[model samples]
Every structure is written in C-alpha cells, then in structure tokens.
Target: MTITRRNLGLLGAAGAAMLAMPSVVRAQAPRVVRYTHFQPGRLDQPKHAAALAFKSTLEGLTGGRMRVDIFPAGQIGPAPQVMEQLRLGSLEMAVVHDGGISGTYAPYQVFSLPFIWENQAIAWKVLDGAFGAEMAEDMRRRANIRLLGHADNGVRHFTNSKRPIVTPDDMRGLKIRVQPAPVFVKLVESLGASPSAIDWGELPAALAQGTVDGQENGVTNILAASLYQHQKHITLNGHVYSLHAYLMSDRFFNRLGNEEKAAVLQATEIAKVIHRGMTTAQDANAEPILKEKGMTVQRLTAPQIDAFRQKAQPAVRSWLEAEIGREWVEKLLSATRAATAG
Candidate 1:
C-alpha cells in the first residue's frame, strides 16, 4: 500500500523509540554479583547469615547500584569448584574454608596445622592484625583472589563410632574421614588414625555406612551435617583451629570503581563480625545440644589435649616445613607468639 504523510510520521516515531531503548536499559541495569558457599541457607548458619548481611549492607550502601545474589549449599558446586570459579572470575565472591582454598594455594595449609593456637583470642589477634593483612595480600597476589576477612570454621575435634578419644593411642586403626587435604591427612595419621580423604558432600554417607568409623570437624559442622546420628562419641581435642576465608574474585575486585570497592570492603568487615560471633556461640553451645541428642561428648582436659597436641605437632610441623617452607612456618609461628604475648 502507498504510504501517507501521517503513516510516515508514525513509522519515524516507532523507529526512534526502538533505537533509544538499548541505552535506557543499560542505564537502568545494576551491577550483579554471584556469591556462593557450601553452607545451607539457614539463618543461624554463619556463612549464610554473613552473606545476607553483605547483601543487605551492600545494596543499601550502593543505593541499589550493586546487587549480590547468594547461592548456598553447594548450589554452584562444591568448594573446590566454587573456588575455581572465583579464580576464573566466573563467580564474584565466596566464603571458603581452609580445606577449599588450600587446593589452589598450598600455603593455606599453614592454617590447617594441629594446635597452632591455644585459644580463639590469640588466633583472632593474629588474624585480625597485620599478620593477617600480609597473608591476605599474599593470597591476592599469588592466587588471584582478594581476602576480605577471616571467619571461623571453629576448632576441629575428633568424633568416632568406635570409642572416645582420650589419648592419641586411642586413635589407632580407626578409619577417620578427613578433608581431602594433605595437612589433614598428616594430622590424622600422626595421631594414629587411618585417614580417609573424603569430600564433604560424601561424608555423611561415608559415616552412615561405616565406610569410615570416625571424622573430625567443628561441632557446627558435625551438627549441621547430622554426623551425630552416625558417630556415637565426640572428643573435643581441638586439634586444628580452622578458619573461613571470605574472598572476592580479584578480577571482579580490580574492575570495581573506588566507591564500590570501599563499600564492598566495609560490608565484608561488618559481615566478618556477624559470622565470627555466630560460630563462636555455636562452639560454646554445641556440647549440650549434642549430648541431649544422645551422643557422648567429651571435652578434653588441658593435659589430655596437650597430649594429643604433642603427638601431632612434630610430624605435622615437619611436613609443613618440608612442603611450604620452614621460613613461612616460622613466620606464622612468630606472628602467633606475638599475638599471644601479653
């Protein structure tokens, strides 16, 4: 049909509207981030809670210019996979533990050593101080991840279906599931238990089927995974004071504007406090809860814990020195001692 003047005017308007839409959409779009972790999305769980805190704070601080989408409970895959995603900038951020991060950066195993800290106060002192800053920078440079803060995995303890662990001698022949990390393998073996390197996803099944008679983890982890249903006894040997590394993809971090980077760091600091408090409270309150669930929970006396520490320390330290360099080991120990000194 022949076009009229009025029809030509209408067609011109429609074409202009279409041409302008792309710029409008780009102007209104928010910068999105994908954050993930292995923990379940329970309000009481530290990682999930912390992620929520970050999401809320970041959106508020950025006035909705940034959006953080959280995926919990291995929604993006296990810790190692998530870690790789973070490295490749496929994932924006994650709260990964020593077990997950160590696979990429071997020196992270330094934190997995047995009895490194006598208590949380000293551990926090070192980690929140300059030493921790140095370590974070080292990770940023070497591993392509930015360490935002350190949260707790709680101090790991031993639990077994076989018997209560009073002494290192009691661990003999017991097949104990451990994170698939050499430091953990060495820690368990040095204490005389046969270490079965199992992925966290498979641990509950491993315990339930007696594929492994025992495992060592924080009380929160034991409770969260319902390992108590399978394991009858728990020994709070407190061998390894584990940590959660709150990390961001270095690629994503480097691309952020100055104000956006500042807001992200501030939000993480806020989250670090919330996360650490939750885990600390869990460690304090878990014993009674475990016992009420009908599992025998034993809190090791000072000497008993010391005994296990003595047994595990030499072999594990030697391994660390050999594997990660004596210089780094000594440097960490020096920092710990300085933190502990009055």
Candidate 2:
C-alpha cells in the first residue's frame, strides 16, 4: 500500500490523540470518600448536616476533584464493624462516639467519665486545645486513625418512663439501659439504678417494650431517635459531656498530597463547627421541644445537679481509673482543672 505525506500526518495525529485520552480520563475521575455514621441522614440531625457540609466544602475546595459518599443510620454496619473497617482501611471516614472507640482506644473513655466537666464551656476549652491534640496523637499511634476534630454528642442526660429522677434515690428500682460499657454500667449502678447493657440500635425497642424503664443519652440523640415518644420524663443531669469523633484513616491521610490533606483538615474544621452549632442549638432548645412533644422535661438546679454529681462522680471516677489507669484519670483531672480554672 502506498502512503501519502498527508495520510502519514493524519496517522501520527490519531496516535497522539489516543495517547492523551487516558490522562484526560484520569484527570476527570474524582477521588471518592466513603463517610459513614450511625445517625439519621436528615438536615435536622447535626451529624448528618455536618457530613453534608463537609462533603460540599471538600468538593468545592478540591475543585470537584474530591467527592464524599455518605452512609448514615448504620447503613454499612454497627459502630464496631465500621470502626474496624476504618482501621483496616476498608472505610474512608466515620463520626463515631467516644463510647464506640473507648474499647479500642482506651484514652477516649476520658470523655465518658461522668461529671468530669462542670459545663460545656470548660469541656470545649480542653477538647479544642492541647489536651485534644494529645488525644489525637495517641489515637494516631494506637488506633491508626487521625482525629480531625471533636463534634458534640452533647451532655448525656437521663430519661425514663417511670418518674422524674431528681436525686440518686429516684434512680433506684429503675431498670436503666446503659451503653454496653463497664463505665456506663458502673455509672448507672452507682446512681442506684439497675443497669442493663443495651445497644443503641436496640434501645428504643428496649424502652418501648419495658425491657428497660429508661435510658441515658444526649438530648439531640434522644430527639433524633425519637426516644421522647417512649420516655415520659427527662432529667437534665448532664452526666457525661460526650462527644462524636471525626476520624480519617491515617494510612489514607498520609498518602494524600499537601493540598488534599489541607482540604480535608479544613473541611473537617468547618464541619466540626457546623455540627457543634447544631448540637448546641438543639440542646439549648430541647426542653421546649420535649415539652411540645408531650413529654415532661425537668431542669435540675445547681444544688440538685451537685447532689447527684456528689454521689456519682467519685464512684464513676474510681471505676474509670480501675478500667483505664490512674495515670489517665489523674491527667484528665489536671487537664480539666487547668482548662476550667479562673
């Protein structure tokens, strides 16, 4: 076959075009993040809303080069399985609670220690500062996870169908559902309640079926899960200033370029603020909402709260020290004092 100069030039151009196609396709393909959580994927839910905000900001910052796919309401699996996935690098990210991680990363249990923080002001100061950095480093070393930031789970409070729980004695004879953690079990038992270890996924059913008379959780959680429907009374005991952890796979994080890493971290901070704001707003507005839903919401005065704190704190702190160590407990107490002192 005879080839002309024009034919040869066309062939070269076609070869060059084919060679460039792969790079074009690679540039267009977005990096996907599988972000999972165990909360309702609704705008009204703080965690879910924050997840959306994170997705938007990260994508925007990356110029659509990054995309996040959110899985909420335990769609992937339970907390333990999801956390395990993150550890194994099978999952990209998650917003798990302190109780969920305490078993694997024992230091996270510090947040679960009842009556540890006097109020949210003191708690945020510690969590958003040096203590938080230390915990983040510990988590990176031990759990192979990067702590992006802390979001609110809000201060856990007591809710029951039986009666108002103003004092420790009022908790007596009540079958209280606690997280399947020794710390929580001890906390409830110390308050004179019979503690039943129930999974959060099963809690609403347990409360509805009278398998347990009541349970403890943050107002946002109770509201999100609609526990107010089953529980008649709520006491703002503010037992534990619990938090939700925003974590990324350290392996994944380390592999990212500097710009990508910055986008992820900055997106996390923005999302953290959004999450905390929603949670705090919900907490502040909870009593009225609960009342509107035909449930009795009781606000404990300083003396009332102090009385329960006096009875419960020492015992729970001792339990925590025994479970984790005296060192962590002492460090936490010192940090708490330093963070809150005038």
Candidate 3:
C-alpha cells in the first residue's frame, strides 16, 4: 500500500472538526416529567395553572432542551401510584397533596392538622418561612426526594347529602369520605362520624351511588368536581388547610449539574407564588359559584370553629407527637407563631 499526503491531510481535517463539537450537546430528549394531578383541566383550575407553569418554566429556563409531559385528571393512574413511580424513578415530578405524601413521607402529615392555619396568609407565611425549609430538609433526609415547594389548595370543607353541619355532633351517623391518612381518619372519628377512606378519583361515583355520603375537599375541588350536584349542602368547616406539595425525585435531581439543579429549584420557588396567587385570587368567586349551583354554603362563627378545633386539635396534636417527633411538632407550632407575629 502506498501512503499519500492528500489522504493524511483529509484525516487531519476530520479530527479537527470532531474536536470543535461540544462534549455534551444540550439534552434534546424530552426530560419526561410524569406529573399528575387529580383535577380536570378547565379555564380556572389552579392545578392546571401550576402544571402548565411547571412545564413552561422548566422548558423555558432550560432553553427548550428539557420538556415535561404532564398527566392531569389522573391519566397516569392515581396519586399513590404516581408517587410510587416517583420512588422507583419511573416518574420525574409531581405536586401531590400532603395526604398522598403521608403514606410515604410521614412528616408531611404535619400540614394536614385539622383546623390549623387561620387563613391563606397565615398558611403561606408558615409554609414559606424558615420552618418550612426545615421540614423540606427533613423530607429529603428521610424520604428520598427533594421538597420542591408548596402549591396552594384551599381549606378542606365538608359536603354531605344530609343537612347543614353546625357542630361536631352534626357530623354523627354520617359516613364521610376522608383521605387515606390516619390524621384524617382520626379527625372524622373525633366527630363521632364514620370515616370512609376513598381516593379522590373514585369519590364522585361513590357519592353518586351513596357509597359515601360526602367527602372533604377544598372549595375549589368541590366546585371543580361538581360535587354540588351530588351533595345538598357544603359546611365550610375549613377543618384542614389543604396543601399541595411540589416534589422532585432525588434520583433525578442528583444526576443534574449544579446550575441545572439551581434552575429547577428556583423554578419551583417561583411556582409557589403562582400557586398561591392562583388559589387566593379564586377564593372570592368560589362562594357565589357554589351558591349558583343551588347548594347551600354554611359559614360557622369563630366560636363554632373554635369549639370544633379545640376537640380536634388535641387528638391531632397527640397523634402527631406520638407518630412524628415532639421536637418537630414544636418546631411547626413555633413556626406558626413566628409567622403570625410577623
């Protein structure tokens, strides 16, 4: 074989061209966020708003190198199934309710304490405070995921096929649907009511068939699910300040570079603002919408709410101190107090 200078020169040009290319070209494949939510997508749905923001902000911040495949209306199984997928690294992200987290992340149940936060402002103050950061760190330490941020969910209220609920005794003899969490079970049990456990996806049909008299959900959820059609009255117990957790699997988060990780985290922080704004802004119009549906809305006085909370809180507080650490509970209360003072 004869060696040729021209062939050698061509090979040298090819090597130089290869060296000019980037070592790691921006990831073009869709990042695939198997995100899930329990709400149907509509013009006014807050979860949808948040999900869209998650998709947009994440993709936008990454310059379209990353993409999210959102699953709304329980398209990717139910909330529990999605969380399990998250644990196994099959799913990338989710904004689940604390009740859903209670199954795997027990500390998250702290947010589900019945009749806790006085209003949205108080809830936001505490959730966005230093204590909230501590709780988020705890989840990362124990639960194999990073706490992204919190999305807003209005107060959990009671709606039943029966009459108005003015007191805890009024909840008696009713088989109300509660979350699968123990706190919810205890909360309903404290009222002498038969607590029925059901997932959100199945609640509507159950209510329609009388399998359950009613379910506790935020006013936004009640209106979204059109639960008014099944139940005659809505008692605004505001028993629990509903919470939506923004979560990211540590498995995925750990794989990213420092700047990419910061982008994801910062995006989540801004999402909390979008989440709260979307929810609180919607509250003023929710009551009128509920009334127009012909379902009566019950607003209890401060004394009435205090009466129920006094009984319910002790059970919840005792249960928490036993299940989670007393120190953690104290921190939560301290955080609440600090936020109120501010």
| TM-scores of all candidate predictions against the true structure | 0.95, 0.94, 0.90
By lDDT, is 2 or 3 better? 2
For residue 40, model 2's alpha carbon misses the true position, in angstroms, by 0.8
- Model 3, CA-based lDDT: 0.80
In candidate 2, where is summed lDDT lowest over 10 consecutive residues? 110-119
* Best by the lDDT measure: 1
| Tens digit per residue, CA lDDT, model 3, 1-342 | 675999889889988878755543433455556677767766478888778877788788887666778778878787777777777777788888878888888888777677767888888888877888888888887777778788777778888998899898888899999878888998888878899888887788999999988788877788778788899988877888888888888798888778678778777777678777877765655667778989888888999998889878888888888898688788888888887788
What does candidate 2's lDDT look like per residue over 217-311, in tens digits? 98789988999889999999898888999999888888888999999999999999999998888788878978998889889998998888888
Residue-wise C-alpha lDDT for candidate 1, range 1-342, written one tens digit per residue: 999999999999999999999999998798998988878899978889999999999999999999999999889988888888888888999999898898888888888778888888899998888888988899888889999989999879899998887889999999999998999999999988899999998999999888999999997788778888999998888899989999999999999999999999999999999988988887887788789878898888999988998889999999999998987788789999898885
Predictions in order: lDDT:
0.89, 0.88, 0.80
lDDT score of residue 312 within candidate 2:
85
lDDT of 2 at 192: 91
Off by over 4 Å in 3: 1-30
Instruction: List runs of model 2 lying over 4 Å from the truth.
Output: 1-20
RMSD of each: 2.1, 1.9, 2.9
- Highest TM-score: which candidate? 1
TM-score, candidate 3, is 0.90
TM-score order, best first, reads 1, 2, 3
